[model samples]
Target: MIDVLAPAEAIHAAPELGAVYLSAFGAPGYDEEPARAEEFATEQIPLHSQRDDFKLVVARDAGKLTGFAYGFTGHRGQWWSDRVAAAVSPELADEWIGGHFEVVELAVVVEAQRQGVGAELMAALMTDLPNRKALLTTFADDRPAPRLYRRMGWKVLVPDLGWDSALYGLNLGVPLGH
Candidate 1:
């Protein structure tokens, strides 16, 4: 089942989560380096957990991690938000940058793919967010992540924003479950 993780729980699960991340993103196209997973667990997750409004959701089967999604409230001056804001037009930046929830990572182990784990993780992570909007970036292809986001009503605001990726936005002011 998918469940929300408190910051402490997430921190505790970092090692296993790193393994899951390595397995998931190691898929054919991503070519993610093995050490990146270690950094994600040791550096990124812990740092992000300190952000305001941080939220994380994980799915486990038989006590093994299958999938997870996490995000936090975004604000001006943060590196990611600032970088994205600089890449897009002022109007687009103003509409979607700060005051939004930034979906940092969503990964499902290869064995768990196409079984609704990603969708469930996203639904649980995004639901009940106090922010009026949310944003994420994914490769600009017809891949599972992009398709899942589009299927859930996330709109592509900027194509090829950087690294051949696209910026996606969701209107939380409207109802979810799309």
Candidate 2:
């Protein structure tokens, strides 16, 4: 089952979360980078936890962390928002980037990939967002992550947003019966 963790709890479990992150993205070239995969798990995840609206979900199998997805409410002047805004027009950025939930990261261990863990983490992260919309960036190539995003109804907002990535958005209209 996937479990939601508060910011503090997520921080406390950073080692476990970092292990999952390393197992998921510890590919070649990543090791040569100064802020390598381990840094992401140790530093980046904790930084994400500092967001006022940060949310995290983890899937466990036999109590082992297999996957995770996390994000937070977006606002003007944020690093990600500013970067995306530069790649798109003001109107488009205003409509999609402003005040939306930003899905910063979603990853599953290699052993757990293609088994719906990523999908579940994504659905759970966006299911109850207070924001009416959500956005994320993924590799521009036809990778499994991007395919999963498309399957979940996310539309490409910027086809080539630099860094060989594309920006995507989803309208989380009023929930049923709301």
Candidate 3:
């Protein structure tokens, strides 16, 4: 089963989360991703722990941690992104960095890769999200992610364009009785 975990103060006070993340992605030689992940886990995670715009969702099978997905809002002035802050909608581009839901990270363990855990996590995240539109990035040739997003009726804007990364999106309506 998958559940969206509330980021508590305890979890944010240690490096275990980053350890797990590094284990999943593998720490290569000093590179951009490692440095970036380091900054994200340390610098931003604590903020996320306290912000309404951020969430961390985890997937467990038989009580063991298998994967997680993290998301937060994007706003206009501080729309923090490595790429251009293009809007999923017409106004998203010009919006504040912290006002739109943006998926910051997602991953599944190797043993759990084909088990639909990612989909389940996404569904649960969608169930808990505070908005209808979400912005996210994934590898262009990612065998299953893009395909699954497409199957789920997500809109794909800004094609690969031969970039190192590709972005995909979904809209989660914040509705009552979720």
- Against the reference, the lDDT scores of all candidates come to 0.92, 0.85, 0.62
lDDT of 2: 0.85
Query: What is candidate 2's lDDT per residue for 1-178, written digit by digit as tens?
Result: 9999999999888888877777777744234243465687678878888985899999999999999999999888899988999998989987997789999989798899899999999889887788988899998988888899888888888888878999998889833212
Give per-residue CA lDDT, model 3, range 17-105, as digits (tens): 56446655663321336665576578768766665566778876787677777777665544345244642344544442345577766
- Looking at candidate 2, the ten consecutive residues that score lowest on lDDT are 27-36
lDDT of 1 by residue, 1-178 (tens): 9889999999999998898899899778987999999999999989998999999999999999998999999999999999899899999999889999999999999999999999899989988999999999998887989999998889899988867889999999766556
Clashes of each: 0, 0, 13
Sort by lDDT, best first: what order? 1, 2, 3
Model 1 poorest 10 in a row by lDDT: 169-178
Error of 2 at 130 (Å): 0.2
Off by over 4 Å in 2: 28-35, 174-178
Candidate 2 global TM-score = 0.91
Error of 1 at 138 (Å): 0.6
Error of 2 at 135 (Å): 0.5
